[model samples]
Target: MVINLSPVYIENSLLFANTLVMLAVGLTLTYLTTKVPNFAHGSLAMVGAYALFTIAAIMFGNQLSQLQLAQPLGLGFAAAFLAGAFAGLLEYLLVLRPLQKRGSTPLGLMIATLGVDLILLGVLNIFADILRGMNPVTGTTRDWRLKAYVIQKVAGLSLGVWISFGIMIGSLVALYLLLTRTRFGIAMRASIENPALAQVLGVNVDLVNMVSWILAGGFAGLAGGMMAFVQRINPATGSIEVVAVFAASIVGGLHSLLGAVVGGYVVGLSETLLTKILSDITGVNLVTYKRAVPLIFIIVTLLVAPEGIMGINWRRLFSRIRSRK
Candidate 1:
């Protein structure tokens, strides 16, 4: 069968996948370290997107070209990253940390994250309203408030594309190195695996948790900022994709970083490709129901292999095959 795919669809799918990778990594990392499914993770990304918007519109007037070395964008990126990290740190320090001290259950911590998510979303809406009142140099207040923003192009592709790809690649490399080559990484792994044991070994479990939240928050922020340029940026932008991000993490094995990365690509492609193929074949517009893709993945994964793709023991399977042979 000849399955002709449009280049635009493919490019968009990759872009979406890359974005999911960023968010999924953060979700998985947070879950690994805290053992809580942080529903507020996506809100942290949304905060980062707004940080980019604030820098580009209010701080720099959206005329970054006049700056040398594109420092404005650089500053904006830093601001977004920092904002995301701060949001995460704040959530942990203010809510999760206190709750942990009081011996809160994992389910309670997870519910707290939901509360944080609602609060953050409300704050974002208020911030957007404030932006709606400000008159920026670029366009109308509404335009500057929460509309889409695009970066300059290089080699005919928007700079946002390169930025997103760079963040994903750089994050992967940095995380791998941090986990495998650094003392902190070792501490983090020990803490995640056994907090009591790690603390006994002088690993500083609390410190590890703080650092992980910071890193996860930073990644989400960077992704959100890059995504704001590629798509529309509003208060709901981050919350809108939480399902896909969660699916990526869960399908990859919530405890496995590599699995999360692979799952992000899988869900990303399925969300786009499946919708297109099914729409074309069934003569029905399935694009509107694309959001259900992740839900389906979640259900299937729960039924078939609750541990997810990475949870499977490949070595044992290979050993059994060899023994039979």
Candidate 2:
């Protein structure tokens, strides 16, 4: 069926997909390093968003023309990355590391991540209050969005879309080079593959894990900074959006970084498009329920292929299907 969608919606979907790619990759990397799903990962993204907001507010007073705001927002991306990296590192060093030393079970570590998420959420709320007191903007503490300020379009799409797409591609290429060409990357691979053996081989597994968290957090922050342009940013925005991130990571194959990339686009586009399509057919507004798409994907993936897309033996399955035909 031909489904005509608005260009705006399409652009938003692509932008959201790109952001998910970064978040999913980060989530997968951290999971690989710690063997635990970080419940606090989304909060890290929010930390980045707030960082961007802080920089923008300070430099431009949270209200400015597109031209005037552009520079600070551009610089805010870097600030966001550092802020997120710092937060992730602190989580690992201050919370996870101590718990690990005490022989915390994987479940315990997972719960600890949830605790960390709550702590981060509280901190974010407090930060929002501070921003409101300082700026006194209408939406400073809630429902912050910069969509109006992003007036420039590239190839008929928002600049944020191109920026997010570029960052995702660049991050993947950098990760590829880091894993394959660099000595440290090789060591990191070894550590992820087999920490005990890597440790015996004189690779500092702890350092590798620490670096992984930093990279993950930085990617998340970068994505969050981009998100401020396209979506509303509140303190709880990350927590609400993490459902899509987890769905992408799971659908992509939690154990495979490449899978995370694939899953991000798949889930992101499907969530946006499918919701639109269904809404049109049913004559009901479904944007509020768009998140249900990712939840369904998670449930279906777990039930149909617990190992995810990357875990399937495609060649073997195809051969079997051919034989049956």
Candidate 3:
């Protein structure tokens, strides 16, 4: 059966928005911990998606079971969430911490993260090959069925968009609570500011950093799982996704959660709209370039403002500055 790429792109645009949430969380964590950009964050997402694949295979083969979905979706989300922290732990213990101890500049730490990213990429490819070669259930068929869950077709699109908006609002509330109402959030901010000061003041700086990573990674994992459910995950998918996420992050402005959210919807709408426009305009098919729009926009945005559509005045930042002034 031949699948039209336009609808695939449309669906994938939604999937990308869902997945970008994970990347935004990651980008936010990196901004907090390392003060240097992380290019390898995409690799972690790849890992999360693969982890879902592995779990899905182990739990369900050649059969699409709701139970199977929950098993991986639930457990895998926990694991993915931890993956973020583990990444943070590695960044702190192996890369940033050591480099900072040696007086290595932030640029060095950033480069080191890129190195970690590449190393993980190679390792993941090896895993991919191994998984590909060995079919655990040697002759088992793969299940590619989409469960028919929704009943109303008339309002599905509007419903989905509303759900997306609700998620955004909920995330904002949760983030605010964490940042302002929780001790751990306070510690995270403090450690981001001055680890030595935080440590001297008895804030377990190392532990807080670890927690942040775990939280960020796990969130990324869950996001990836949600995406895999909505789309499909292969062993070796990369910039195919990172590009869209980069766009959303840029549009949302790199460090702000709200920016990421707004950026996601913008990219989602733009993806659908662009494909429609291109399909009509040049008569050249845009299925190939639909996903690429986000990346292209990211580059364009960076070249222009680079500060992101939301700017740096995060809600938290605004509240803090107002208090100070």
Candidate 4:
């Protein structure tokens, strides 16, 4: 079947895919360190989004010029990252850490994340109300997006698209270097591989775990900041988006960082492009139901390959196929 490959569709896919890559990586990082799925992870992304919005609102008010908007882009992202990192660290220390010390079961810890998510959501709502009262840009506190200010393009793509792609590439490269070339990275890897052994060998496992959460939150924040350019920003935006983030991580294999990257692109592109294709053929608008794509991925991955993409033994499967041929 012939399917159109439009520029708009490609841009949308890349923007989403890049954002998912950061989020999936962050989710995997935390899971590796703490061994629990963090439901509040998405809320952390909204924190970053709000940080970016606050900066933008403070600097230019509601009437933001293209140049003015571009000026604070970097600073806003930095603020978002710091804000997200702080929130994540607080969650670990105040809630998860204390619970772990008290010997909370995995299920209990997971439920604690739900509580954290609700708390963060309420805080975001309050913050939005305060922003509205301050009147820093009309409607800046809720359903905010960069569609109006996104006037510039580079090489026929929105500048936001390039920025998202750049962030994804830079984050991956930095993570690689940090994990492979730095002493802390080595220690962190050791902790992930075997916390008891690493602790016995003089590695500070707690420190490593703390750092992982920081990195995870920072990444999520960065992704959320980028997300403002593509999607509407609201206090609950992250909660709605978390399903896709979890899908990417689970499909990639929660135990494998590389799997997150692969899953992010696969799920991101399929969600956008496949939805478009089906919509075109069926003559109906299916964008609202696009989330089903990721839900399907999660279910299929669980049933067919519970360990996800990284769990498959490709070489063995390939040998069997060759023998059959």
Give TM-scores for every candidate, taking all chains together and pairing residue i with residue i.
0.88, 0.94, 0.74, 0.94
10 residues in a row with least lDDT, candidate 4: 133-142
- Stretches of candidate 1 off by over 4 Å are 1-4, 59-69, 135-153, 313-325
Cα deviation in Å at residue 59, candidate 4?
1.2
lDDT of 2 by residue, 72-170 (tens): 877888899999999999999999988998999999999999999999999999899878865532366666865666647878877777777777899
Which pairs clash in the backbone of model 4? none
TM-score of candidate 1 to 2 decimals: 0.88
Which candidate has the top score in lDDT?
Answer: 4
CA lDDT scores, all candidates in order: 0.82, 0.86, 0.61, 0.87
lDDT of 3 by residue, 107-199 (tens): 887788778777767776777666764333222112221212111223445223333334435555776789779998898788887877988
Q: By summed lDDT, which 10 consecutive residues of candidate 1 come out lowest?
A: 141-150
Residue 132 of model 3, lDDT score: 63
How much is 203 displaced in model 2, in angstroms?
0.3
For candidate 1, the per-residue lDDT at 67 reads 25
Candidate 1 lDDT over 1-325, as tens digits, reads: 3355775566567778897898899899989988889898888998887787777765565444442426656888799889999999999999999999999999999999999999999999888788876545345332332212333456766555666788789988999899999999999999999999999999999999999899999999988876665456667777778889999998998989999999999998899987888888787888889999999999999888789889988899899999999
- What does the lDDT read for residue 290 in candidate 1? 94
Cα error of candidate 1 at position 186, Å? 0.9
Per-residue accuracy of model 4 over 1-325 as CA lDDT, tens digit each: 4566688667878888898999999999999988879989999999988998888777765555576666688888899999999889998999999999999999999999999999999999999988885544435578777645663777888888878888889999999999999999999899899999999999999898898889899999999988887777899999988999999999998998999999999899889987888877777877678989999999999999999999999899899999999
Model 4, CA-based lDDT: 0.87
